[model samples]
Target chain A: MAPAEIRNALASHPFLEGLPEKYLDLLSKLAFEVSFGQDEIIFREGDPSSLFYLILSGKVALEIASPGRHVIIQTLEAGDELGWSSLLENTSKQFRARCLEPVRALAFDGARVVALCEQDHEFGYHIMRRALGLVAERLRATRIQVLDVYSPKGVRAQ
Target chain B: MSTASHAAAPPARPVMEPVPVQIRSVVKETHDTFTLTVAPPPGDPVSAFEPGQFSMLYVFGVGELPISISGDPAVRESLTYTVRSVGQVTYQLVTRRPGDYIGIRGPFGTSWPLKEARGKSVLIVAGGIGLAPLRPAIYSILRHRGDYNRLVILYGSRSPRDLLYRKEFAAWGLLPDTQALCTVDYGGVSWRGYVGVVTTLFRHVRMQPQETVAMICGPEIMMRYAARELEARGLPPAQIYLSMERNMKCGAGFCGHCQLGPYFVCKHGPVFAYPEIKPYLDLYEL
Candidate 1:
C-alpha cells in the first residue's frame, strides 16, 4: 500500500488518533503492509527487534515455547498492536507471534521510529503514552490469566 | 408456626414436589464430569421447563443437591444434568446405574431470556461445567433459529479435555448465524485453539452491541469480570443476564440456603438481569 493509504489505515485505529501531523506523516511514510498465512510466524522470541505491527485483520497468537509444548500467552485480534519491544531500546521480542489465521498488518520499521522519537521528545511522549496504555492493558490481562479466574472453586468445576 | 395456618397453606408448585426418576443413562463427559439422563417413573409427569431452570437431585442413600437441567427442554420424557463429582452427593449421583431410582424435585428457578432475546443477537458465555445450565438455552435458540439474528457462544474450560458437549459445539457452529469459540486455561502439546479467559473473546465477536442480549453462567468471579467486560463493550447491564449458583436445599423458597440478599435464587431466579444482582455480587458472604 502507498504511504498515503498506510496513513489512512493507521488513522482508522483509535490508538493512532490525535498524533502530530508530522509524526503521523513520518509513520505513514515508514509503514508498509505485511501479511502471513495461517500458522506462519510473524516473529520469534529473542529475535532482534525489527518491526512493530498494527493488525488490520485476523488474529495473532502470542506464545512461548516450553520443553515440549507451545503455550499461547495471549491472542491479539484486529485493531491490536504487537512488537512494542521493537521501539524500546536494547529489548528483543519477548514472545512468539504466530498468525492464528491469514493476518494483515501495518508494519513499521522500529529502529527508524525510535530514531525519530529521540529527535522529537513531544512526539516520543505521545507514542510512549500509547505504548504504556497497551502495556498496562496487557499486564491486567496477564494477571487475570494467571489467576485462572474462570475456574470454579468451592464445589469444584461448577 | 400455628398448626391450623400451616395445614391451610396452599400446595407448593408441583416443581417443588420430589418425584421418583430412574437413571436412564450416564455419559462421562470428562475426567470428573458425568452427564446423567434420568427418566421419570411410569405414569409420572416429568414437568417441562424453560432453559436455565435447575432440579434438586436426591441420591437416595446420600443427600440432595441442586443441578441444572442440561437436556433439551422440549424433550419431555427425561431430564439431563451434567455433574462433576466434587462432593459426597454428586459422587454418589454420578455413580448410580441405569435402573437405580433417585428423587428429583424441580424444574425450578427462573429461566434464560429466550423470548426477550428473539429478533436480536444472542451471546452465551459459559465457563467450565457452567455450560450445562446454559445448554438447554442454546438448544432452545438453535431450535428456533429464525427468531434470533446472530448467535455466539464463547466458552472457557480448564483444558480441552474439560470441555462439555465437545461433539455438539461443531454442529452448533455449522448452523446459520451461529458462532462457537472455545478457549482453555491451559492446553497441551496436541491442543491447538485460543488460550485465555472467556472475557478475551469479547473482541473477536461481531455484534450490534445495542441490539444484543448476553446470558452468562460461570464461577462468580468469572461472571463479575465478564459482565464488566460486556458492559465495557457497550452492552447495557440490563441486556446482560446471569445464572447464579448457591447452596440450595429446598427447590422452593421455603429454605433459605440459597438466599442472595433479597432474592431466593432457587425460586426468584437462577437467571437475573445483571442490574438486579450487581450490588450483591461482590458483597462479602453474599
Candidate 2:
C-alpha cells in the first residue's frame, strides 16, 4: 500500500483515529507494510519488542507458554493495535505473536517511535495517553480472560 | 417450519402449567453441554418460540431449570434446548433417555429483534452456552435471507472443545454476505483458531454501525463490555440488544423470583434493548 493509503487506513483505525495529521505523518515516515504466511511466528515471548503493529488484515494470535504448550491468550485482528511493549523502556516481548492466517500489518520501528515520543513532549503525551487506553482495555480483557467466565468450572448456570 | 411470525405475547392458555413432553433426542455439543430435542405428546401442539425466549424444563421430582430455546423457530415439530449440565436440575434433565418424559412450562420471555432487524445487517455475538439463545435468531435470519443484508457471528468459547455448532458455524460462513468468526479464550496444542475474548473479534466485523443491529448473549460482564464496544464504534444503544438471566421460578409475571428492578425478566424479557436494562445491570444482588 502507498504511504497515503496507509495514512488513510490509520486515520480510520479506532486507536489511531483522531490523531493529528502531523503525528500520522511522523508515523507514516516509519510505517511499512509487512506480511506473514499462516502459522508463521511474528514474535516470541522474551524476544525484544522491536516493532509496534497496526493490523491491516488477518488475525494474529497472542500466546503464552504454559506447562507443556503455548496457549493463545488473545487474538488481534484488523483495526486492532498491538506490541505496545515496544514503547516501554527495557520491556521485552510479553507474548508470542503468530499469524493465524495470511496477515498484513503496518509496522513501526520501536526505537525510533520511542525516541520521537521522548523528543516531543506534546506528541509523547498524546501517544502515551492513547497507549494507556489500549493498555487499560487490554488489562480489562486479560482480567476477564483469567476469570474464565465461560468455563463450566468458573460460572455455574443460575 | 415457520411458527407464528410473532410470539412476543403471552399464550392464551394459562402459562404456568407444566405440560409433559417426551425427549426425542439428546446430542452432546461439548463435554458439558448437550442439546435436548423434545416433542410434545403425539397430538399436542408443541409450543413455538421466538429467538431469545427460554423454556422451563421440569425433570420430574428433581427440579426445574430455565433453558433457552436453541433450535430454529420455524421448526415447530420439536423444541430444542442446548443445556450445560452445570447444576443439579440440568444434570437430572440431561441424563434422561430419549423416550423419557419431562415437564415443560414455557416458551417464555421476549425475543430477538426479528421485525426491526429486517433489512438491516445483523451481528450476533455469543459466548459459550450463550450461543444457544441466539441460535434461533440465526436460523430466523438465514431462513429469510433476503430480509437482511449481512449476517455476522462472533462466537468465543473456553476452547475448541467448548465451541457449539462447530460444523454449522462453518456452513453459515459459506452463505453470501454472512461472516462467522470463532475464537477461544485459550487454545491447546492442536487448536489453530484465534484466541481472544469475544470483543477482539469486533475488529474483523464489517458493518455500518448505524445500519447494523447487534444481539448479544453471554455472561453479563461480557455483554456489558461488548455493548460498550459496539456503542463506542457508533452503534446506538437502542440498536444493541442482549439476553439477561435471573433466578426464574414461575414462567409468568405473577412470580417475582426473576425480577430486575420493576421488570419481570420472565415476562418482559430475556431479550432487552441495551439501553432499557443498562441502569439495572450493575445493581447488587438483585
Candidate 3:
C-alpha cells in the first residue's frame, strides 16, 4: 500500500479514531501491509510478540491447545486489533491466532514503535490508553464467557 | 380482607381449562430442544397470538409448563413452541409423538411492541432458547418489511450446536435491510462463527439509537448486560424491552405465582419496558 493510503487506514481504525494526525503519520511510517490465508497461524502461544496488527478484513481466531482438543477462545474480525501484548515489553503471545478466512492487516514492528513511544511521551500515553481499553474490553468478554451464561444451570441459577 | 359484599361476584372465566390440541410434528432443534407444532380440533382453528405471548402446555399424565409461542403470527392454522427438555414435564412434552394430544391453556400474556415500533429499526438480542420468543417478532417484521426501517438480530448460545434457526440466520442476513449475527460462548476448531457473549456483537452493529426499539431475552443476567450495553450506546430506557420469565401457574393473573413486584407477569407482561422492570430485576429471587 502507498504511504498516504497507510496513513488513511491507520486514521480510520477504531483504536486510533481520535489520534492526532502527527501520530498517524509517524505510525504509518512503521506500518506495512500483511496478508494470511485461511488456517494460517499468524502467531503461536509462547512465541515472541514482535508485531502488532490491525485487521483490515476477514476473521482471526485466538485459540488454545489442550490434551486432545483445540478450543477457540474468541474470534476477532475487521477493525479489530491483534497481538496487543507486543505493545509491551518482555512479553510473549498468550494464545495462537489463526486466520479463519483470507485476512488483510496492517502490521507494525514492536521495537520501533516502543522506541517511538519513548521518544514521544504524548504518543506513548495515547497509544497505551487505547491499548488499556482494548484489554479491558477483552477481559470483560472473557468474564462473560467464563460465566457459561447460556447453559441451563447458569440460566436457572441467575 | 373482608368477604362481605352486597352481591356475590359472578364466576370468572375458566382460564384454567386446557384446550386439547394434537401435535402435528416435533422437530429437534438441538440435542436438548424440540419445536412442537400443534393444531386445534376440527373447525376450532388455533387462536391468533401477538409475538412474545406464551401458552401453558399440558402433557397428559405428566404436567404443564409455560412455553412461548414461537411460530409466525400470520399463520394461525397452528401454534408452534420450542421446548428445551430440562425437566420431567418438558421431557414428556418433547417426547410426545405426532398425532399425540396435549392441552394448551392460552395464547396469553402481553407481547412485543411491534406496532409501536413501526417505522423504527428493531434490535433483537437473544441468548439460547430466548430466541424462540423473539422469532415471532422477526417473522412479523419481515412479513411487512417496508413498514420497518432495519432489523438487527444479535444472538448467542453455549456452543455452535446450541444455536436455533441456524439456516434462517443466513437467510435473514441476506435480506436488504436486515443484519443477523450469532456468537457462542465456546467454539470448537470446526466452528467459524464469532465466539463471545451476545453483548460483544453490539460493537459490530450500526443503528440509530433513538430510532431503534431493542428487545432482549435470555437468562435475566444476559438481558441485564445486553440492556446495559444498549443504554450505554445511547438507547433510551423506554425504547428497550425485555421478556421476563417466572413461575407461571394460571395463564391468567388470578394466580399469584407469576408476580414480580406490583405486576403479574402473565397478565401485565411477559414483555416489559426496561425502566418498568429495572428495579425488580436485580432483586434476588424476587
**Model 1 DockQ class:** acceptable
Q: What is every candidate's C-alpha DockQ against the true complex, given to 2 decimals?
A: 0.46, 0.58, 0.54
Overall local distance difference test of candidate 1: 0.83
At residue A118, candidate 3 shows an lDDT of 95
Q: Is candidate 1 or candidate 2 better by DockQ?
A: 2
Give the Cα-based TM-score of candidate 2 against the true structure: 0.90
Q: Considering only chain B, report the TM-score of each candidate against the true chain B.
A: 0.93, 0.95, 0.94
In candidate 2 the C-alpha lDDT for residue A119 amounts to: 95
Report the lDDT tens digits of candidate 2 across residue range A20-112: 989988888888999999988999999988899989888788889988788878878787887999988788999888888889988888889
What residue pairs are clashing in model 1?
none
Kindly indicate the candidate among 2 and 3 with the higher DockQ. Answer: 2
> What overall lDDT goes with each candidate model?
0.83, 0.85, 0.87
Put down candidate 3 lDDT per residue, B1-286, tens digits, no spaces.
1111111121133568888999999999999999999996544423567889888899888888889999998887889999888888988988999999999877778788887789899999999999999999999999999899989999999999899888988899999989999999888999899998889899888889999999899998899989989999999888899988888888678988989999888777788889888899888776
Model 1 C-alpha lDDT per residue in residues A42-63, reported as the tens digit of each score: 9999999889899999878888
Candidate topping lDDT:
3
The sequence of per-residue lDDT tens digits that candidate 3 reaches over residues A9-106 is 99999989999988998999899999999999999999999999999999999999988988998999889999999999999999999999999999
Instruction: Return the TM-score for candidate 3, rounded to 2 decimals.
Output: 0.93
TM-score of chain B of 3: 0.94
